[model samples]
Target: MLVALRKIIRHFKGDEDGVALVEVAMVTPFVLLLAAGVFEFSNMLNTRMLLDAGVKDAARYMARCSSDWDTCSGYAKNLAVNGAISGGSARVTGWTTGEVTVSKSLSTPAIDSGTGTELYLSSTANVDVVQVSTSYPYAGVGFWSYLGFGQISLSVFHQERVLGW
Candidate 1:
């Protein structure tokens, strides 16, 4: 009985017939997960780049405008959306026009006093510096949602020395 048991154990340990199959079974899931992670990361990078480009374009437009804050804000939003739309066919399905927000404010260094209201370029308060900021909500992709990452809020702001208008 002992000899038979030893022979069985040796046979099982030396058997190579199904070894490859077992190795593949163990490694396949990890390889698939790695591929999925790469895809998700690339998608996120592309989306962020598009959003940043949009914000930068909008900021440049706002810097050159001598219009009221409200009007400039509208223009900035439009420019940002258009920029994002132009980047690629991939669109954030949950995103909307209302999701984009534009704001104008004095530069932080210039507002060191932290006293009184910050001035926009349209205001006559010796506006030496102005910053244009835009924010958008990135609802993330299905994979991200599955991983419980949920939504990621993204914002971009540009500051330009108020060039002589």
Candidate 2:
């Protein structure tokens, strides 16, 4: 019985059939985490780009119609929330009117000293400025959320000189 037990132990120790399975098991978690990170990052980046494009379009539209405050406000609000000229084109979820801000002023300083300064309007001689801004909360998906990383706040702002109607 002792000799049989020793032979069984030696056979089990020399077996290589489970090596691939062990390696895969060890690497699977890291691969899954990497894939999840890439997916979440890509989604966040796409959302930001969409917000930027929408904000710029909204700003330009408002600037062209600065004289009509009501129209500009409505158009900007719709564009910010929906990412389209008309309604019902919202690319990101959980957007609200409060997240979109539209304002006009003669002073360029106000526009310069606001969030999203990278898209600030160029100063023109005697032209009014219109600024449009939108904010979004990006909650990480998949493994990101599971790792205790919280939501990220993103915003886009664009300013353009009002073209007299």
Candidate 3:
């Protein structure tokens, strides 16, 4: 029995049947990391697209005056929650109004009716990006500083021309 067991052990030691499996085990971790990176990249890209669309939608809402700073902010916030946009918080900024000047109108018949006035208004929403301080749980290692795992910020801008009501 001892002789048979020693033979079996020697056979396994010299066997190359599982060489491919050994190689696979060596490479599997790298392959999995690459796949995970690709998935993360796709997610980031999708988030960016959603952010753009949300900004444009909020801009349209603002143009109609159906939404104000608070409403726009709320809409942006909801969008973030709904995956229409990403980040943490939304803020209203770059709110402005301008007057449009144009000459000639339907009322003018072969005559100059002077300049026509129209109101132009726009607003922007800013979203606070997920900060590393909030998102990434820091380990007790000082290597985080060397790795530059720190603050990150991102925001979106939206603008639209207001239509005269």
lDDT of 2 by residue, 115-142 (tens): 7453344554344677888878886565
Error of 2 at 47 (Å): 1.3
Q: Tell me model 3's lDDT, rounded to 2 decimals.
A: 0.41
Off by over 4 Å in 2: 1-14, 109-126, 140-142
Best by TM-score: 2
Model 3 misses residue 33 by how many Å? 0.7
Pairs in steric clash, model 1: none
| Superposition error at 160 for model 1 (Å) | 2.6
Off by over 4 Å in 3: 1-15, 66-151
Task: Return the candidate ranking by lDDT, descending.
Answer: 2, 1, 3
Error of 3 at 98 (Å): 26
Better of 1 and 2 by lDDT: 2
Model 2: how far residue 114 lies from native, Å = 18
